[model samples]
Target: MNSSAGRDFRVVAVQPQWHAQDFTSAGRFRAWMRSQLELARPHIAGDRPTLVVLTELNGLPLVLRGAGWATRLGTFRRAATALFVVRLPRTLPLLLRERVSPIRALQLADADTNAELYLRTCQALAREYGVYLCCGSAPLPRYYRQGRRVRRVPGVLTNQTVILAPDGHLIGATNKVHLTPDEQTGGVDLTPGDLNDMHVYPTPVGDLGVAISLDAFREDVLGHLGAQGCTVLLQPDANGAPWTSLEGLPPDPAQLRDQPLAWLDSSWKATTGGRVRYAVNPMVVGNLLDMTFDGQSAITGAAHEGQPQSYALTGPRGGFLALMPWVETGPPEQLRETGRQLAAGSGHPHENLYRTGVLSADLHLPPSRVTPPTPTAHEEALAALLNGEGEWPRPTRSGRPAAWLALLGLIASLTWARRRRDGDRGRACAPGQRPR
Candidate 1:
């Protein structure tokens, strides 16, 4: 790896499909990994680029998706059959399997447990891969409140982002501040930290800022990256439906109003010259039906006033790899001139008072950070609701007709049971005489 930096470099972003069970066994996953490295290895060996970035969950999800049971037999059948082919029995113990074996409680679901296993597996994969891999976040254990000043005991859960470099070295990581609603209060009942925060990993190439899905949606988050000297931003996301080619589809004329990309263009024009690399690698949902990932991976980079460049690879509805070159852009700076030019401009007729140029709002300001304020319990709860957390509300106890009918039915059933018992007692007493 190139430990020092200079110009004339290349970068490969690997977008591997990670949904189904094809990548479960050490052999299958390692094969996929080898293929990805083979495709991009030349660049690294040739010293074209010193870094290789991989998407999150490149191994574990494939295994979990493939695990299953045999019909009529009590024993669970491994979903992936390719395990023995690749010598995985020897490797399974090395895997991160905390979630698969945790003490099951009523509050924890299979999904939560699997997520934990996924995290453990990721750590193991990073150690073995020996590349700069941005393993995404998994939840960690935190204190949860049951209700009314009662606190549940703390234990580890799955949550948080992880990054590993080549040779299995850990870099920096950031926990997601803005979780999807289900991840917030109630469902998993997690407490969210402040927003507008980021973790900057200073690599040999340059500083990289990593964020989760919703974190990218905030303008403040973007600002935080720009101000902190981050030249590239990486997002490991599982967002909307995975897309195939947009070919043969007609543009919607009614929806032809200006969109955000256009605004982005204008913003770039107004701003000082600086380059920002934004990459989004979302898990492709379509290819998972057969318990497999459709490595429909894509990457997009936006340069100031330049055509947005993107690279993608979608294939055989399973795991595939894509490697693309990326040019690193530095932060902005002011213009300078020689002494002779300065002297010449001092007496120039056009340089009388003010400089003649188009005024740009973006150029006038300094960059800032995006950090959200700490939230109160009530506010957090409401935010959780917005994020799709909380229990389903029950029917109100107000005396509406339905409520009254339910109440009446319940009372009638209780009264009838009591009367039946009393009648039996009365019959016995009448036959015997006044009972002692």
Candidate 2:
């Protein structure tokens, strides 16, 4: 929330610390979040419009808080199973009422509890701080709110990104429209968000946009939101890869020496198109069960896109407003040296990676574009397809078993996290940075 006399707006990016202990109790989670928000209070007291942002999946681990005895389990699957056993009384009613698979019922039960905790905690904090807040993405099914009650809309869970106003009311929400191979095929089975209905929300500073993780890389989703006159883009992230890996990067003569920053294109390059003036990428860092999320959070400007990029891809001319220190250094290959070797090389406990970064900067923002907020061509086409303007393709008999296979694969994988190799999922967006 830092501001200067002539600045048009301000951004406070909270690169949050994620750990099971924080969400073990309602008081702990709220207190942890409140302290995080307190870091923004210094920047928010002025007339300048300020927006506070958290990283993607910032609230996803809240599930561990509500799921009974989950924090005590050694791995995710074990915790989930323990959760079912611990909450059998509540879950039995859901099973009888919905008659869905045990897995599906578990997801619904999860959505029923954790989503509210995430929303209420964020809403209350936004109001207390009196600042606009983007609470990152949470995994929840489609839900409707009716006078303090949240009801499920009978859909698979989606990575839902929500923006809250200074008064603490929800401004708008968007879901992840692109699914990684793991998200779709993984047992989690997240639902991809539709593009046609996506739109920008009005903020005091300008129109705000939400593109959680891979959705920021999507042409359709970005096109639709850009069409709606979005000025600032929020690409909240929790990359499950090492921050410095250079896997799968497209060659830029400029990037061959340092390919890590190439992945910033998901947001930075997208802004050079002129519609988005600024992009805020706040990332979560820490271990969730055996999974890890690491990254250096940043706020970059489009006007500086023409400037020579820094290794961090930031500066005043269209570079970074602020960039956090990276967790690892040196070449991606050296860093990727065998898993055991890599693990042994680092004496610092992974818990040492849980540094909470609070970055605030005053930005001289542009006037919002005068274009009418309208659906982009991609959105229209998608709407048409969904409206039955085109035929709905039926799944083949061969495709029928895919769900069961994905579920089995997910269960098998989740059953033993120690055996799961570390690659870049968070880094997958970065190209070959994800390990093979």
lDDT (10s digit) by residue, model 1, range 219-284: 666677667666546655442211211111012222321111211221221122243443434332
TM-score (all chains, Cα) for each model: 0.45, 0.74
Candidate 2, residues 297-404: lDDT per residue as tens digits? Answer: 777776454344443323323556676766444554554432213221244444434446777766665454434346433223322332334332221122324455
Q: Runs in model 2 with CA error above 4 Å?
A: 1-7, 66-68, 89-104, 145-150, 246-259, 273-275, 303-318, 328-351, 365-436
Candidate lDDT values, in order: 0.36, 0.61
What TM-score would candidate 1 get against the native? 0.45
Clashes of each: 22, 16
lDDT of 2: 0.61
**Candidate 1: regions farther than 4 A off:** 1-9, 23-39, 42-45, 56-66, 70-130, 137-159, 182-197, 240-286, 289-436
**Model 2 — which ten-residue stretch has the worst lDDT?**
391-400
